[model samples]
Target: MSETQMPAGQLSGNVLFYSKPEPLAKELHSKIGVKRMDGPFKFAKVGHAIPLTVGEFPLAAVTGPIIFVGDEKLPIAVMGLNAGENMFVKDDGTFESGIYIPAYVRRYPFVFANDEQNNQMVLCIDRNAEFIVDKGYDMAFFEANGEPTEYTKNCIEFCNNFEVERQRTVSFVQILKDLDLFETKEATFTPANPDGTQGETQKIAEYFGVSEEKLNALPAAKFVELRDNGALGQIYAHMHSLVGWDRMIALALTKAAAQQPQAANA
Candidate 1:
């Protein structure tokens, strides 16, 4: 199975990769740690979209297009053209090397859960993560004295940074929403006909994007505010990332061509 074995009746919240998340505690997990595992990222193989922070737009833009989705206008990095297909992730579960990987994916197996009553965030881990293991494994969660190990502290700090970026993304989205800059858009592709004629354009996805018309139409004062606050750069990053749609289409065609022979054999 591609997905993790989550606990029955457990709410998954928003993260698609996490399953069986548990609060990390020295008492409960004194021996728990992470180690290199074959197919460590296989759980993410079927996921085409991952949450993106505003901080990631520039780097993520180069790899794949970023789009806003749903009423929330949540930003996501588009990694594949269809469901259950991640072009960047090899069959062995290792994401393609020499390409930008989102912090959302790198921080996996560790996440934060809000302690609602305490008004605090608690560090949690996917109890069923393939890398999680007993003692003698790499990157132990705690030292013998019960303090968090350096590795664990680093992971926690990374999660904390992600939370900060995530909050910043919320503000960015709010600004776009207040400016009414969003436009509904569709991803389309036209395949070449066997006779070398132009084919009808096929729509692949429907999503929300920053409307260039709306952006250019903004009041001068509003445009200045966006630039002064650095949102303009991120907006441009997102817009530039739109070109990655063509890259995705190319990868999809390549993968499809490779599969045809296997299908014929079967």
Candidate 2:
């Protein structure tokens, strides 16, 4: 299906990472130039969650909670447990040092849009991006000869690679779904009170994750199929990523306390 034809419930709209995705064409190339991203990550401040391609699971698992979203089971690295807050992003707009940045976020300002009529994907960019420049910039989308530059070509290649990984992730999630191994789960956190006592437990978020029980119950034949298909490692990575939930809770409690100092002091 074309991106525009994606269902409202899907995360394809302006809400899914990119703010405004417009096809990059020769007609628009003259008006577009991108400055080197010199400062912190200004583009990432808009959203707390970043999408994850299947290949990023192992590295992302070490950085944050990796979970699936919506019916499509799109993988995402949870940067923050609460809305409008990202623990990984510092005040300077850069991610925390040494943390893994998902390719979906790194591919920011550029993406591949589905060309439904042609049944293919086209390269697109966010015109509203701050790094876009009209003139006096070393970076240019196209040369004076009207050919795409190395920078634009590199972006296309990156987007293409991400698209390939995204498709693989779709198949991975489908396998889990078909096996009925996914289950809904909620994470609760209880912070220590100012008096040095345990406080009330609060449910932080709800999400879908793999069920170990169901996976273990799978027939030996099915298990062999997953192993032979090279999906077993990914499944194990996802399950192991759940260990980051505790880290998320710790970060959330710190943010909560910082937001409500009075309660924290009480």
Candidate 3:
């Protein structure tokens, strides 16, 4: 498909950390010199469901609800309830102050790519990123000797660390799946009408989450095994993160009201 036709989570081939990623080459690097990030999140548009690693559950739990996305059960931070809207992002493009920022968002503009032919990972940058600058910048991808600059080295290191955490998250999700701990869940929202009456209940989303009943029914030895393996904490963290679902609904309601022409006129 063409770049414009790419779905959410998928970006142009040159965009790293996107669902479809292409290698960052020296040629592209030359064109995009050391540009500093322009806005708080010019790269991230509305409705971007950022993938969360196992290490991020604690902080992410406080910022937003963490839930499984497709059949593979990939965990994601819910940034918006509806399509094409990010409630956490202000009109100035800055994220809400004091909210816990997920590592997935912090590692942006840099990512690791799988080099299948060489059986290795390659550090890459999004050539189309808003932060890229061709000249008059403090950072450079390569020095005069063609060696990577310190800035490039730091980005590579962060991408490598994120990759390691991503792999660990895969293992964590696999264990949950093997134990049959996940179940379908739904989040509902009921808005209050202007007349002081309850509005119709709306089911905003359906996702997969840890089954509390199954977790409680696990054998004592199995529970001990999970605790020993450090999976129990992650599970509880995910469960606790559900508390943010209501918060998400409230934000979504506020956004909806703000967008309504009638409300705007009032």
lDDT of 2 by residue, 41-149 (tens): 7667655678887788889899877888788887888888778667787767678887898888788788776556556666677767778878766778887777788
Per-residue error (Å), model 2, residue 120: 3.8
List where candidate 1 sits over 4 angstroms from the true fold.
1-14
Model 1, residue 135: C-alpha shift (Å): 4.7
Poorest 10 consecutive residues by lDDT, candidate 2: 1-10
lDDT per model, in order?
Answer: 0.86, 0.77, 0.74
lDDT of 2 at 1: 12
- The most accurate candidate by TM-score is 1
142 in model 2: Cα distance from truth in Å? 0.6
Model 1 residue 37 distance off true place after TM-score fit, in angstroms: 4.0
Q: Each model's TM-score, in the order given?
A: 0.91, 0.87, 0.86
Candidate 2 C-alpha error for residue 52, in Å:
1.0
What's the distance in Å from true for residue 14, model 3? Answer: 9.9
Q: Give the per-residue lDDT digits (tens) of candidate 3, residues 1-266.
A: 01112122332233324543435555445444655544557445564577889988988899788999798899988877876666677766578887766777777667765554445556555555555678677688777766667877787778878888999999999999999999999998887899999999989889999999999999999999999999999999899999898988877667676779877687
lDDT of 1 by residue, 50-138 (tens): 88999999999999899999999999999988887778888888888856788888898988775554455667788888878886587
Ranking by lDDT: 1, 2, 3
| Evaluation by lDDT, superior candidate among 1 and 2 | 1
